[model samples]
Each structure stands twice: as structure tokens, then as C-alpha cells.
Target chain A: MHELSLITAMMDLILKDAQSRGIRKITRVELKVGEFSGAYPHALREAFAVASRATPMEEAELVIEEVPAELRCRECGAVFRPSETGWACPSCRSQNVLLQGGLELEIQSYHGRDGDVGQGRSRQGYSSGEQEES
Target chain B: MSVKVVVGKDILAVNRKRAEDLRARFKQMGIKVVNMLSSPGAGKTSILEATIPRLQKVRAAVIEGDVATTRDAERLSHLGIPLVQITTLGACHLDASMVWKALEEMDLSRVDLLFIENVGNLVCPASFDLGENLRVVVLSVAEGTDKPAKYPAAFLSSQVVLINKMDLVPYTDFDLERVLGEVRAMKPDMKTFTMSCRTGEGIDRWAEWLEKWVRESQ
Candidate 1:
């Protein structure tokens, strides 16, 4: 599955960052996968288990947070979760809608042990923008 | 001791950056790039073979992606156009980096339109952006009408949907209205084209629209 490729890419990113921060071994990884990101959490875990072997994340715990898909109506400026059968705005019944969320596929953070002091440390990768809903 | 790192980074950040760079290059060269996606045997190559010749005024090039084999590449070799083929070996989809590498093998200076035929898959390709101006998902009548509902990622991300192999519609249980209805419910603004590559039906309108789009991008 393509989830393997995604997991490999994610591991590369995490390992590179971990190495730079003097992390000897990764203990945990947290990911935010959106409903529309085309990646399933179960598949991701299976991929992670396969991709992390012999790497710093060999024994790491993989945590995934799924985000629900949200749509914003352009005509009515209303934000709501799309119905299973349609994406039309519930408020004004407009078909002019934009996806407001549920397309995210990102690494939120990681837990590791520093090589020198053997102390656990946490690093913030980047700031995510506020997702506003109406 | 366990430490936490805040890595609020998009998983495909590297690929996205490369795609953005490719987009800038395409824009600079005034090339309209169209990325085509579909499942196996969905007539992507057939449609291209029939439509490219009708492009008429537009100068076109193609970068074909396949899991293995260059058969698709050979099919279009008769067009006498610049073509490059990327055989991914085992990768299920083409990332922007692969496309970036393929571009280095071709000359796009005189190309008005560039068609990137992605690996025949509806899933993984939807998640990877190749910096194309338009994304088209090709569905054949044999694939059934429920494809849009089953593979929403591909349908949702695509701007255009081409329902190919209309000649075989009577032989299959494909419901055109149902498929269009589902697509409309998901994406109301999506442009749709129904065509039979064998009979050359509906090819002219698609080719004309494509040519106009290419010219407008220039």
C-alpha cells in the first residue's frame, strides 16, 4: 500500500530531526491524519511497524489523531460537516462549498532521549494555523 | 528520559516544496500542466492517443509514469513529440520529485501543454500534488458508477472527470446519471466529459477545451 511510502517519508523526516537534536532513540511519534488525507491510521501503524525496524524509532509508539472533514459554504458563509451523501450547505442549501479541514497529514511532535545526558526532551516542529469554523 | 518535539510539519512537506518549485518553472515557461489519474485499464493512454493529435494549435509533450514497462511510452512515440517515461519499479504513485527529475530529461521551452499520466491508481495519486494546473480523473464505464463514492479522495481532489469508453456502456451496468449525480453532490463545480475513445465521440469538444486552456495559460 502507499501507506508504506508515506510512513517511510515520515520516518526520514523524524529521524533527520531527531539526529540533529542529539536524540539517540525515539520513544514516541504523534501524527494528525485527516479524514480526507487518504491515509488510514491502521495502515499507517502497520507501515510504521515495518519501516521503523533497525532505526531510532524501532521501539517507538505511534499515536495518530484523526481529524474530521469540514466544509465551508461560500454562498452562506456557513461551516458544517458534510453529509455522507452530499456537501451542500445545510444552512442556505448552497452547493458552492470549500473544504475547510480534514485534509491534514502532519507530524505534530515526537518524544526522544538525548544521547549525551540520556534525558527525555520534546521539540516543537512548527506552529499550525488556527482552524476557524462558523 | 523521554523528551517531546513539536514537529508540526506536513508529512509530505518535502514533496510539496518540490512541487511548488515545479509549478514556478511551468508558469515561467507558460506551460499548462494537466495531471491525469485513473485506475488500471481506464483508457488514460487511449484517450491521450486520440486527443493529442486533435490538440491542433497546441504544442504538447508528455511524461508518462508507470509501475514498470514502457509500453505506454511506446504507444505515444508515433506522435513525434517530446516524451519521457518514468518507471517507478515498485512505487504505487508518482511524487513531485519524480516529476521534477523527469522534467530534466525533456525540453519544455516550446511546449504549450504538458500532460503527466500518473500511475494508474485512484488512491495514492490523489494525496500527492504534482503542481499541475488541473487534475483530471478518468473513469471508464466498466469501472462502475460507485467509483466516485468508493474513492472520494481522487474525485474530490480532481477538477475534471472524464468518463471514457462510452461505447461499452450498454454492455456494462454503469449508470451515467448516477455517477454524475454522485460527482455533483461531492463537487458541484467539477467539469465532466463523457467520451468513447474507440468511436472518437466527444473527443473534439474535450480537445478544443484543452487547446483553449493551454492557449489561455500562455
Candidate 2:
């Protein structure tokens, strides 16, 4: 239900960065959403569809990568995926556990059209884009 | 003509930064903040009403969050403590910015314990950080025992869990052991307190623990 607010916050960040970099239109957005991040992927997709309207991302494709929940047992030094019914360590049956993963809610990257470089130039031979990891 | 921009930024980075700033400010002022979360009608207000008076050595303040109501703020007004009411108007949760705005309205010069009663929803609030020293989840017996299993995010994120409404347990099918077991399975070291605000049971223990934390923060 708070997906709309989350989408708005995410759009604020992405659009600001995109605008500063002279990105005229975003084509794809990749987000890493954890299973336990307290946000539903389907809901986020719906929110994105609504929030991205009339913006640079109006026709963008929203890509979500879901991360599974992981727990590490303190006593047994074991790492495992927690069962739906319990979070105890499978190796030692210890309840002392720490959530090692699956709380991520991050925007990994986006594909955007370069506004400065593509000003009515020849559109041929520019299908593949260069990769930049920050 | 297309380029990939690698952001790798957290979605809630703005809220997280605000919460961190508030945390630093609270630490400088020697204030221990307790953020309370629970479902609707889970005795959050009643627990506050019962526990506030028992904080004999601590000067407490409250920030009440609701979708749209001043009643909770009014309930604690007779306690004579500095209180601020934040009506979200329709928001399901209170983020850090809202809390920062609320803090501007209060004077925390002599306050030792600050309680922020978040809006009544277990899901969205768990994702928000309000710069509180402790996160307390109040689960009443009337809410049923499967709450921990159903709402693992809240139970896992909270450091303390208060099982309220002990008096109503006999009438309901609330299994105390099952709830505690599930809670422990998620967080083994979660500090839990079973109390009844109506009957005044276990209030002293809860209040003393809170006062101790507040005094230790100072």
C-alpha cells in the first residue's frame, strides 16, 4: 500500500540523477528488491506504471530482481535460507540468528538515451550501449 | 545513443540520512527515543498511559502519529509532559522527515525518554527508521498468536516486544508460548514483556526497564 510513496521516492532519485547526466528519456530501470524488504514487487511495478507516466520514463520497462532471505546462525556459524515456519539454524538448531541478506531495496542501474550525443545525428550503428558500473 | 547509468543507491537513502541526523542530535541531547509500533487497537495508547506515570525518575515526552486524529495526543496531555501530535492525514506510516518536523515543535531540553507512537500498521512502519534508540512492537493477546509468523518483519526488526492485554487471554485462544516461540525463532534475544494495561500487571517491570535505559543514555 505504501508502494506509491516508495515509487515516488525512487523516481525522485532516479530522475534527478538522469537529468544531471543529460539523460532525456529512460528506457529501462533495474531494481534489486529483497524478499523481506517489506515491499511487494508486483505492487512496485504497478506503482511505477502510474508514477512514470508523463515523465522521462513513461515507456520504460521496470525490471525487478528479487533477493531471497538469508540468515546466519551465531552459535553454529551456519548460513541458510530461513524456512517459512522458523528461522533457526538447520545445522545446530540454534535460534540465535542474524539476518545476513534479503533486506535490500536499491536501484542498481538504468538505461537512458543520451540527450547531448543523439541530437538529430545518424541513428545507425548505436544499438549496443557502453557499460558503466559505479 | 543509449547509456547505462549505474546508480547503486538505496531507495530510502534520503529518509535514512534524515534519521541518522536525528539520531546524532538525540545522542547530543542525551535523549533515549523509543519508537512504538503495532496494529490498530493494540493498546499502544493504553500502554503509554500506564507506563508514563511509572517512569518516576525520567522526564518523558511523546510524539503521537495517527492517520487523522488528535485523540491520542489529548489522552497523554493530562500527564503534563511535552507532547506533539502528528496527523498523517492518510499516510500509512510516519517517515523520518515527519518526525524531524515534529521535533521542531517540542523542546527536548530536559527530556530523558521520548516515545514516538507510530501509526497503527505493522507493514510499512517496519521499513522506516525514526532515529530511535529502541524499536518496540506491542502485540496484544486479542490480536492472536499468529501475528509473529504473519508479520515477521515487525517482529524481526523490533528489539523489544510487549505482549499486551494479558487479561483478555483467558477469553481468547491466544497461546502465549506459541507467540513467544515464533518471536524467538526470528530473534532469539528479543526482550519481551507480557503485560495488561487495564489490570496494571507487569507495568512496573516494563517501566523500570525503560527508565533504566533512559538513565543509562544520560
Using Cα atoms with residue i matched to residue i, what is each candidate's TM-score against the true structure? 0.89, 0.91
* Residues B120-156, model 2: lDDT tens digits: 9998998889999999999999899888767778888
lDDT of 2 by residue, A1-134 (tens): 78888888889987877776667889999999888888999999999999999999999999999998889999989999978667778899888888878888898888888555344342233332234522
Task: Assess each prediction's global lDDT (C-alpha) against the native.
Answer: 0.87, 0.88
Q: In candidate 2, which residue pairs get closer than 3 Å at backbone N, Cα or C atoms, i.e. clash?
A: none
| CAPRI verdict (incorrect, acceptable, medium, high) for model 1 | acceptable
Q: Lowest summed-lDDT stretch of 10 residues in model 2 chain B?
A: B1-10
How high is the lDDT of residue A19 in model 1?
Answer: 82
Off-target runs (Cα >4 Å) in candidate 1 are: A70-98, A115-134
Interface RMSD (Å) of model 2?
A: 4.6
For residues B99-134, could you state the per-residue lDDT of candidate 1 as single tens digits? 999998999888899999999999899989899999
Score chain A of model 2 by TM-score against the reference chain A. 0.84
The alpha-carbon deviation from the true structure for residue A3 of candidate 1, after best TM-score superposition, in angstroms, is 0.9
Rate residue A133 of model 1 by lDDT: 14
